[model samples]
Target: MISRLITILQESELLLSDQEIESFSEVQPLLNDEDIADALWLASKIGSAYKVSEPAAIKAVSESDDAIAIEVIDDNTVVVAPSPMVSAYMPPAAKSDNGSMETPELGLPIQVQAAPALAHPREISRSLRPLLRKVPSLTRSELDESATVNRIAERGIWLPILKPSPERWFDLELVIEASKFSFIWQETLDEFQQLLEGQGAFRNVRTWTVKEAATGQPQLVAKRQQGTGIEQDQPLRSPKELVDASGRRLVLFLSDCRSRLWQQGQIHDWLTLWSQHGPAAIVQLLPERLWSQSELDVGFAVQVGSLMPGAPNSKLQIRELPARTEIAPADTLTVPLVTLTAEALKQWALVVAAAGRQRSPARLFDLSWVSDPERDQAMAVIQPQSAKERVELFMATASLLAQRLACMMAAVPVELPVVHLIQQELLPEVQSVHIAEVYTSSLLEEVRPNRGRL
Candidate 1:
């Protein structure tokens, strides 16, 4: 193995960079020189993982990324990589209710669990129907005006400061944990449609033509509503439009909640229809997560003099007041720079909001819906803090989602499952450093109808 791997590495040396060679060398000392063949093979594989110029692909498999695929050859001889698109192996730490475990013959045992893991499927689903009906109805009612005002008043002064206080930090962590259900456990509607198509609930899923604004060429948009017998004279501009169209796929494209559009009469109308005449599924892929901030900001303080044209020494200074008394002088705190512009303030607001979401439980989750034109089918982009938290939320989301879905699908004679993809990142504009898909479930088996007495 050592001789063959060495030969392969020597042949691929031209493709491999010096930095990659160094990375492999760091791992080599832990391996036995006698068993150098396996070490060489591991090193060569890792070296090949790094493309010459492709940063995205490189970042995906890097050691720093939340590596779903990991092999522990030994403590020091661990091999790790990004999770593959599909695998036969059950995710790591996958616990079946029956306490049965299956190990595939080909590879190592995986450590990740799939999403939507539910215990009491029937009772949960039944309870969720009322809220599924109520929230949307309230959003659409004439009382929406008062509801919005009341909601804002109820969530008074939730945003935290740039530097979190001890109490605020504890609150943020709780909120992040609670809101992980929306962020971590999600999937594309198209993927879910595929599962339903197999179950015969959804048939004849087809793509439609929508001309791109930038290029006159047609863009392929999945129009699953085609065979569902819902017709519209004009294209659906919003979810409110879907109500009149009476389509199976009434996707409320709420991309942002902070905007005024979400609070409008259209959202109210859309929600009313959703509650009254339910769709087969209400899969909200994008939950109001920490990463829901419109702007990504990393705050910095620069001296007022640093902004002057031709100022060679452009460095930041933490403005501190001189101590009035000898004892108090040493305890003086650094003041916020006054020179910060409106853009900087806006940036700071996003940072604070993001931080507060991660730190403060006092900050309420924004459940309002906003309009988006890009996505035709459902898609979710999750940003949970950890893999374990993501897995827990995935199951909770499935259980919660199953109940709502049960209400929607109750009208339909056919038993339809609420499928969650859990892995795909629908939004590319989000520049998240650490994120991963924890799991996907069709919810068919997990959310089975009550076999015994209700």
Candidate 2:
């Protein structure tokens, strides 16, 4: 308190005698810490407010603002009128040469950047336009009868003379597996949901996150808005809820297909029920090249074509589907797996709508992967000890994109802003998932958690 008083006296341009400074010791004990703090704050505020003085000037009538006035209302008291334009509590604003108050120049508004998707968003959306759908309701939607008439005139014989309706659509449910490995596809699935909504191919596109419940069964959950403006998931439903036996709901599962459940037959069981009831399929996140490495068994490769082929009389003739006489019973009934590519997706939609007439082009996964995976093949495992060895192992096992990003980031060694720079400027294909891959690969360390720079 005594030293503070001395400093306050010095700032006021007043040199106090040693004896005068010592006199504050006598009053220091009488004031509490709160009182001392208030005094110091007030002294500092007054010092900054009036560090320098200038002559007062009046403004024109057009800008006639409220003026602050000090009035002697009592014998030993003064009442100062408050001005709203600039409060006395705040430090006075500095004016420019033209007499206008100066402030920092405004900059652009900040925005949060979204993560990049696996493929071009628009292209993927366009490719999904031919998803297998139930027959559209001709009565409820606009139809082109001219096309039906033209088709009848072109063909010598007329069938039902039905018109095609594009507007009538059904509800769709997209279930994304909420697991460590599967979460990497979160950005892709989110963009997919938005694209489905934009396409208006479904009456309503509902998104769900599938997670294991306490009962050890995988349950489906949907996110809902709470009254507090926060998001919360709805109560998880039983596995049976995942299957609409009436075939009214269309469900699509976005998964990496490497989970333990897939090998345990749990995923297959649910898919069986869903496929039996309604249009259901799995969208594998991994590329087609890596499909063999996943839990899905490498079944016999067959070309999926239409049920009828080489009908010259038919205006729209499709290739013939594979014969069922030679194929095993297991291959005839199995869940369809598809990649995000247009060709794979188109074939999947065909098999889905074929309704027993045709099956997926991909092999019917064998139960060997689920029952006895180690029967024929020997597993090779390596334990890396050194950091360099660990990094080498990670690079060997990581995705090609992640490996590329890790090499680039290692060479550059940037910190926080490096993500946007790499994604936007250096490599447009770089995704937040790839950056995270490098973070988890043991190739980078958190040098300083609190700092923006590393």
Candidate 3:
């Protein structure tokens, strides 16, 4: 009977280990009719839980003569009829002495519910069960290839690649543009401005007050008048008001109301505003306190442009800011920004892919990676230290990297190096854009238990 049951189980697509089969055989003799029923039910449950086909589970049930009935609850669940033990567990009728008063209620047998069927001991063991669910029987060649690739992809470790460098310095500019319109939240701006005035670049700053048309609130606009004898009380609201700034580049702080920086519309707006002022260049400053996170070793953005002139995408550059660079305690701080020429952008992409190979906490690249054949070949040379390490690597790069890159695309496909070839092919047509900017300020506030609230 045990051998027959094993054959049925295998026919039903339930693969059991040798030890499991032996254990099932050992316990087969001890199972009453009820136990057999329960075992069959357990088998059905196992098949369903492991995503085995419903037909396979049904076939297993039909093969078992001991199983009076089988009912499928869903693709993942099954129900079996009550065992003989359950049907036979009625309470014995009470005996009446002399049979003088035979009360129907007292003579009637009381029905007792049967206990739930127990799965095979070996089957119930967590360690052994996982081994059983090793694969599905999908055998199509295309499907098999897809499944294999997906399994590897799901493992989440991006294989890093090393390629020949172009040997030219990435000529990029970090344009820090400031506008008279303050983008900083009023309270945050006030506090930060006070701190700046107390310490670094704004030691001798002149201020002008203007009432906002929308809010009717007084907005204090600050300017660092170090050399030109502009009075501290001069009322300057717009870029046009700065008459003393003749030939030199105008550094103004424009408040970015919208948080997303990659939007083409935002870039267009900046360009339009810059064109009006006629400054040789513009400098934009992001709140340093908000950007600083231990995860990112660097603290600055670079200037990057496309290979094609007038590409629909913005010419914004991104790069790692050195951690040790001195920050002036001013609302406006100056730093060199790099612009990415066509070749430079490609080189940067290669460098980014290479940097991802290192197992270190970094912030330069949004948690995204592009796969290349060369990178995969390079990564194949190194073996993961242990199972734990391999698992960790998968979890870090898996969905995180892919999702971030998707977001960076923002409905427009930019031909970036190091991404998969398929992604490049799909770029022009892939319209979905999901951008997620990592603001470390919020994370820092949450993780620092000992520090006071920012």
Candidate 4:
């Protein structure tokens, strides 16, 4: 019965077939249905160990019988299924208490229903099983259509393009005029070129051209053209075409030319040379002109009467008057004045020294003394009068120096005001004079011959 069951499974392409049963029966003639069932169950168990279904195990065993099936060489020497196990095969069913259906290898009864057989046999292999289980088969046209849809969805969109700009269209020009003349003119083109090359601010200048003008040429003399947009092969105007219209020789200097020249290479050395030798060189080049102008003299006078002590008893007299030398436009002078009482002068020799030190070309004026008749009377009335009856006399002298400053400058006036002299502790007594006002007048005055002079 097991052999017939195997044949049915093998032929039906289901759980067991007739061909597999016949092949197994041929291998062992004495083997009963129980042993055959056991072998089929072992194959199913191997398939189950690999997570394969019963139908897959059955198909695998039938297709590769040498790896999955038990064989018989002769009746007495039957060959059992190769061990350590061959390939994976189907597992057996368990036995149930009622004995209706059971797979002993799985410890449970088989539950799968068998598939119907067709006239033609369907070949089973490991490669054909998975496709047979899910898709059965696929067409090339359908696979291509699916791939095309996937590619279209994965790609991005296209964008618009921009145009490029044209290469050429505009021109520029610089117009220069050469008619203007500079103070320090360069005589020749070579000289001008050398000057431009020297340095400072004029180093990079290459702009202007110079030429001479004919007598009958138009007043508008020279013109300068800029090279900013000109072609490399374009012809330029000759030096003769550019000229200074005025009859005098003309020289042109472009703005910033001199400054640029001063700033170029070796400028520091050039500047040092100029600083050390330039001024003297210029003085030698240009000498000062002589003056033929005449000179004029002016007169100034100061009053001498202010130096007197009291009211005059006689007319005033003019003694020797001081004379001052004429001064240049830029000079300064100082004058000194001195004053003291007769008793103070007799007590202090410093007072006299001070007067002598301050003396100038000026003269000393003497004033009439106030006479004491009583002192003269005492000298007559008593034989050897006491010193107490002697008269006390006070006198003061002042020395003045006239100073002239600068030929164009006039002398500034100074005033003298009367002031008392005071003595500080341990210090010599000194008289102080204050200046009150100043006036202008002649220094010479006429007076009686016998009058006291100050």
Best by TM-score: 2
TM-score of every prediction relative to native: 0.19, 0.53, 0.19, 0.10
Tens-digit per-residue lDDT, 196-302, candidate 1: 23422221223322223233222223343457666333452333333322222322221212223322324333334432332211122322232233110011122
lDDT of 3 by residue, 156-202 (tens): 64444333322211111112222222321222333334432442221
Q: After the best TM-score superposition of candidate 4, give how far the Cα of residue 165 lies from its true spot, in angstroms.
A: 29
State the displacement of the C-alpha of residue 374, model 3, in Å, after optimal TM-score superposition: 42
lDDT tens readout by residue for model 2, 120-222: 5666665555543446554555546676678788985565454546542346878788764443454556667777778766766777777765655576778
For candidate 1, the lDDT comes to: 0.29
Is 2 or 3 the stronger prediction by TM-score? Answer: 2
Give the better candidate number (2 or 4) by TM-score.
2
**Candidate 4 TM-score over all chains jointly:** 0.10
Q: How accurate is candidate 3 locally (lDDT)?
A: 0.32
lDDT of 4 at 136: 15
lDDT of 2 at 448: 37
Task: Output the better candidate (1/2) by TM-score.
Answer: 2
* Candidate 1 segments exceeding 4 Å error: 1-187, 201-234, 237-265, 279-282, 286-454
Q: Lowest-scoring 10 consecutive residues by lDDT in candidate 1?
A: 168-177
